[model samples]
Target: MMLNDIAMIAIVGAMTGVTTVLFGFGGGFVVVPFVYQLFLRQPAIANNALHIAVATSSAVMIVNAGWATFQHQRRGNVTADILFPLTLFIGLGAVMGSLLAGQLNEGTIRLLFILYMLVTIVDCLVSRRFLKGCEARPLSMSTTTVGGVAMGAVAALLGVGGSVMTVPLLRRHGFSMKHCISHANPLSLPVALCATITYTFDGWGKIPDSGFIGYISLTTLVTLVVAGGIGITISQRYFPKIPDWWHARLYVLLLIAVLIAMLW
Candidate 1:
């Protein structure tokens, strides 16, 4: 890659890393759209640009999630009781979601992502009562399992780290924002791995390039992982000081930005 491309990748990686930790999501919300636009500029990959973008974003999350999880674990924020079961169900769902994504057209995927963002905004705005109740009583096992599956599926389909869904759900279930983020960080690992593997084989022969394996770009992955690691480490040190109310607002604002980026 040229110096300009390297520079762009580094910038995106830095942003992804910070957001991944900040929101406890895989950063796919940021990475996929940007990569999609970048791919669009290259006529060679335009035909499968969305697929490549999504898959590559998922692949990058493997590293992003690992780094974030390590940071959270170090802070004693992760709850193993919640993490393991959710990871299992989410991984299964991620496989299914990746397969489903392969069958859909680009326009449909984009539409789904837009709708997902809109629904998230509405949920955040109207679910305060439900959240309070959840805080009082944790969700049942069956409910958490079902929710994990659904979250994993949607996240894999959209190339996100499943945090967008997990964080809010956990918050509603009464998990502190820190706990929600901590749990959400590790869950991305299974989802990313399953989705990445599925996408790799699904697009094996379809995408032919030395730097690419199926739809993933190794150069981008490496760059993002390194920069993301730095971002996560820095953010974790300061995130605890941010007030809870501000976290909600920041999450909402981030979603809004993602919405605009999608529509743009």
Candidate 2:
């Protein structure tokens, strides 16, 4: 509500936008840590800082991921055949995950978040499949069923969305870095929607502030969406110019940076 708060959040929003478009994060990775820290200072919500952060991250993703998916669709980067089947299961998992997240204590959620990031960063770094993927192939039913549900569940629980899982999964199927990340947008959309709705009702009247609607910060959500929109528009023009190899490398580096931020 203060000028400084608005400015700082807007900055975070801009960063969220860039990540959403470039890495299919949809503000999940950027918003969670920051919002967690922000809410920690409020006595009323201090104990639930991470909860509010995770829920708000989900809310922000609804717009960021959805819009990014639309843009990706125009570019012919989305694989509908692969996307449709996975999407349904992801939604189911997201509902389950959001419920689970609400039951977790703050410390437990933070630890799990840190551990998940470490594993993901290590996997992306050591895995040869991430850089030079194979030919594009249809995902098997079993793969989509298990992977989609798992991805949505974990993503909703951690508030990181499916980019961390979906992109890597798609990469092995021979998608270029751009296409792999592009596909993540659509996959993330369902997780955001389902998680936000679940948390909204589950967290009703829990946070004492008027600014929050359930566990989500209504003001921050709008700011991030607006700022993220500008960022997405700017990034789209330059996205195709990046080399695939660099894209893969940068993704890993971004993961590392996020890991450090979480720890910090």
> Which model scores highest in TM-score?
2
lDDT, residue 78, candidate 1: 82
lDDT of 1: 0.82
Residue 149 displacement in candidate 1 (angstroms): 1.6
Residue range 1-264, candidate 2, lDDT tens digits: 677787788899989889988888888889999889887887888998998999989999989899888888887887778788899999889988999998899999999999999998888877788876667777888889987899899999999888899988888777888888888989998899988998899899998879888898998888888888888888876656678888888898998888898899
TM-score to true structure, per model: 0.93, 0.96
- lDDT by residue for model 1 (61-165), tens: 888888778877887888777877778899888988999998998889988988998998889878984234354366688866887788889989988878888
Candidate 1, residue 57: CA error in Å? 1.0
How many residue pairs of model 1 clash at the backbone? Answer: 2
Model 2 alpha-carbon miss at residue 84, Å: 1.9
Please give the lDDT score at residue 154 for candidate 2.
98
